[model samples]
Target chain A: MTDRYKYMEDLLNRFFSGETSNEEERELYRFFAGEDIPAHLRRYKPVFSYFESGLEKELNLLTGEPAEAAEPFRRAMPKRRIRIAAGMAALALILSVAALLFLRKANAFDPYEGSYIVRSGVRITDTSLIRPEIEATIQKALQQEERANRLLLSLSASNPETRIEQIQRRINRQNEEIINRFPNEMKESIRRIIENK
Target chain B: MKTRHLIAAAILLITGSLSANLPAQETLKALVKKCESMDNVNTSVVRNRNKQTKKLEKEIISLNFSNNQALVNEFIAAFEKDKLMADKEIEGKNNGKKTLFYRFGDTSYSFSQLNEGSASVSVIQKDEYEYEE
Candidate 1:
């Protein structure tokens, strides 16, 4: 640990440059691990031990050479760790892509047609149910028509001069009923009259 | 001799009146038959009539219970179709003895249903607006 700072700088400079391959790096670490190393370099030994972690395991698996290096070797430790890390990264990438696709589909909407629409007093929708209020309204209309018709009939009985007025009144009331009952037909007839003129 | 002549004259008068106008009344049934069978009269086209119930031919736009029937029909059949039914009715106001129809509309008119009798204009969807006439 004495001259550890100077040796570490030298090793670091050599480490960063393209000068040391994995074998050379391991040899440097082994040299630092030796007990007889100068006190100056002993403190620097721990830094180079990091090199032992990455090197011989994967290379020994490929070359079939590490079996003789240690008698009770656990075998190719670094290669297994690298494989496990790579598999985890791949799985995470697949899940992220799947989640992104699911979110995009969930937000998509159909823009072509529409559902029910309500406007002003009239509300229209898919279901066919008539309201009680509408029935009451229709009843009021019928009552009015009945009164108008009765008035015109009585007036007709009273005098002959008002016959045309009576005819017009009767026609008007009938017209209302016709339009109310069968609007489409009545409308067509009126249109015909106008066009003829 | 005078009694016999009176009876004959009455019969002749009835026959003349019947001959003069009976065809008009009969024409509606014929038109109905024609409409029922004719491929040109599409029920699907009139199905878009909201709040209005309709039975129309190619040229007609029947306004229906929704209070637009008379106006719709008159606008379409009378103006557009140029065909007339002898018996036609419209919802209108009482002016003196005549019930004058003020519900006038042209092709540009809006056929809409509202709570009050106010119509909001809309650009009809394509293919939704069909006129055989």
Candidate 2:
């Protein structure tokens, strides 16, 4: 028994130094699995037991047995995939929002935003204060244009001839009324004189 | 996959920039901007709104310049190429005032030179107009 303990101690030292072979490591595991370990060396049993359980799980996975060997890998792969997907989604969302704001600002069409008024070497750009003056100026301009249009219509080629004819008819009608009001004998004389007969 | 996402983002940015880079034509609004920077000129603009909807329906721009025959002539020369609806060179009844009127699309422009060496230009823009014979 003392010889066995001495050998076990030597194997433990080699394992710590990473010089023990696989067979010797397996033997240490088997020794720790038994309850006959000396009290002084029993403190190292848990470490060998943990390594033995881990190796068994790895072997079970290699043999296609259902075990915890694939749990860490399964959990790790999805977490990485989710992180990548989330990053892309956030990037797309930021780009979309920025584009929307830029387009809206670029396309907002207000032609009169920079309208202003200059008077007597002074410039007035406040829309609210100058709006009434602007409206009045427009009204005056429209009125002036309307007057010009009316004048042009009156001066058109066909208007003066029609006006002359209407005026001639009215004058003849007035002369006839005046003759009828005069004495019957004098009416003929007056008509002859007016016609320059 | 990452390269594809980056390419799509680049395409979207390029499209947006291209749309923003479209050329703008010369309009009355552009003329108003020019007039704003000119010396000895008075410029005014009025936006007409619909009473019911409270939305902008039309715009009116007016410019007045005193003793600025050069500017008046410049405007006359520029507008002469456009379709003129009325051209009264000399109105003897109104002290020889010259008036020119032009209509294009839904906009109308009038340029007038008064006897006192004052020139006025008026622009009226509407959403639409009824067709006249």
| Listed models, DockQ each | 0.05, 0.13
- Candidate 1 residue B25 Cα shift, in angstroms, is 26
Q: Give interface RMSD, per candidate.
A: 15.4, 23.3
Instruction: Write one digit per residue (lDDT tens) for candidate 1, span A1-197.
Output: 54665565576578768677777676677776677676655666766664465445667768987634854454567677889999999999999999999888655422111222233324343322323323332343335434534544564456433557546654444333333232465566543432332
Per prediction, the TM-score for chain B is 0.23, 0.65
lDDT: worst 10-residue window of model 2 chain B: B81-90
Task: Give the per-residue Cα lDDT of candidate 1 at A81.
Answer: 81
Q: What is the lDDT of residue A171 in candidate 2?
A: 53
Local distance difference test, each candidate: 0.39, 0.67
Clashing pairs in 2: none
Q: Which candidate is the best by DockQ?
A: 2
Estimate, for each residue in A99-137, the C-alpha lDDT of model 2 and write its tens digit. 999999757544345556777657887777786786687
Writing each residue's lDDT as its tens digit, candidate 2 over B35-117 gives 76677787777776665555677777788888877776666665553322121321332456767665544566777786465
Per lDDT, the best of the predicted structures is 2
- Which tens-of-lDDT digit does each residue in B1-133 have in candidate 1? 5665565456445544444433221322333334334333321111222223232211222212233334334333332221122122223333221121111111211222332322212111222333211
